[model samples]
Target: MSEEIRETQQQPQEQTPPPAQETFKPRPPGQRVTMKELLEAGVHFGHQKERWNPKMKKFIFTERNGIHIIDLQQTLQYFEKAYDYIADLVANGGKVLFVCTKKQGQDIVKEEAERCGMFYVNKRWLGGTLTNFQTIRKSVFKLKMLKKMEEEGVFDQLPKKEAVKLRRKKEKLEKYIGGIENMNRLPDALFIVDIVREENAVREARKAGIPIVALVDTNADPDLVDIPIPANDDAIRAIRLLTSRIADAVLEGKMRREAVKLAEGEEADFIPEEE
Candidate 1:
């Protein structure tokens, strides 16, 4: 056979379309609370409350109208469920607003949020943060204006001695103006540490059609939250563990997304050649 014919025969034929990739369900977030941990928590704090009845022997965390309490095992299950729901939301491209009135709770929640690369409102939840995103954008715009003025030599036009003082004033104003960089965009969901204390923020989130995932103690109403995690709001250990579980879930969801992309790429590469 001629060399040209041999080379032609060796060449691959037309490729067939790749098969549709299978969708993967991501793992749910939050660590499982073992029965031992639940019992220990009950023993440590369950008896402290005068209202706690020893006969009931089943104390779970409860929340209603923003108040919180930890008394029952059912609360642990609630936390697990809430954590999974939040994880699913985050994995599916939803944003979350983290709100907490207490400094300790805010700090704990903020740390977990940062770990998961999500935004939070540890400070006071500004009114209309969700409802009136344009107003917040205007604030951010004002900051940008100040920065532009400084860069364009507007401050330099001032008397040499007064320029430094003017610059200091500008810096002070910018410092206290609050964060409005991403303010124009409202979160897809809200995760409140103390739903009662930050009720206004929660209400705004609700009005904007944002789903809420909140830590509900006995004192707060569970009805307020779309997904309520019943747990000890006062205990640092409990708070940290619960928040971390949610963060981990978000991370896992992100990983699953990346994995899906990779699988699609591999399948494209392996398409069979059509004769």
Candidate 2:
């Protein structure tokens, strides 16, 4: 081949080397949050409360910016960080416990948990639910007893005139104790929606060594949680936003697992079968 032609062939054959592998640096803790943003967050969530104690007032101080506060900002930042942590856990086949102190918080959390296939402490955090797990198991056993009684026609055997009333009362108790029957074990991680309101649950979880992720309002002490997100605890918008973020993290983890499975399947397909 001519020199020019040989040079052209060599140029075409020269490998465009594989792209450089990207290196990922670890993110610093609390790097996602700042003091000013936390202060503003507190102000946004503080407007509805009628009264504030001295500590809360100090934490949620109002400046010339109308009502500068840190609670809302801190809560939001906390959620962001907590969600990031949760995503890592879920990616590793971990579970989360969603607990709320407010009445409706249970239902809200339950809905989210079901959507994400995670656990929740929607019912009252029964004493010894974690420390004495078998004791809580006994409660589940009682639910089995109720089921057995129903199956054996025990309710029908009651006095005919009183049977309906008795059945109604039983149903009421069952309704009140909706999610309690499922609480046979402690959660790996606990997410408390209202830290101030659910302080007892927090204490119990702490004693059991379960990691805690909580939404801390201005009135709540941040030290109670392993991961605290300062935000408007009472506002549905804020709660939904934060909870959804956590749920999204869990879903992302699930997707990652599925992708790995698919990749494995493709690899298997490429393997040669015996001749």
lDDT of candidates 1 onward, in order:
0.61, 0.63
> For model 2, what is the C-alpha lDDT against the true structure?
0.63
The 10 consecutive residues of candidate 2 with the worst lDDT sum are 1-10
Give candidate 1 misplaced runs (Cα > 4 Å): 1-31, 35-72, 142-180, 271-275
For every model shown, the clashing-pair count is 21, 14
lDDT (tens digit, per residue) of candidate 2 on 196-215: 78878888889999998877
lDDT of 1 by residue, 207-227 (tens): 888888876654456677787
lDDT of 1 at 89: 76
> How many pairs in model 2 have backbone atoms within 3 A of each other, for residues 3 or more apart or on separate chains, i.e. clashes?
14
Error of 1 at 15 (Å): 49
Tell me the lDDT of model 2 at 220.
72
Query: Scored by Cα lDDT, where does model 1 land?
Result: 0.61
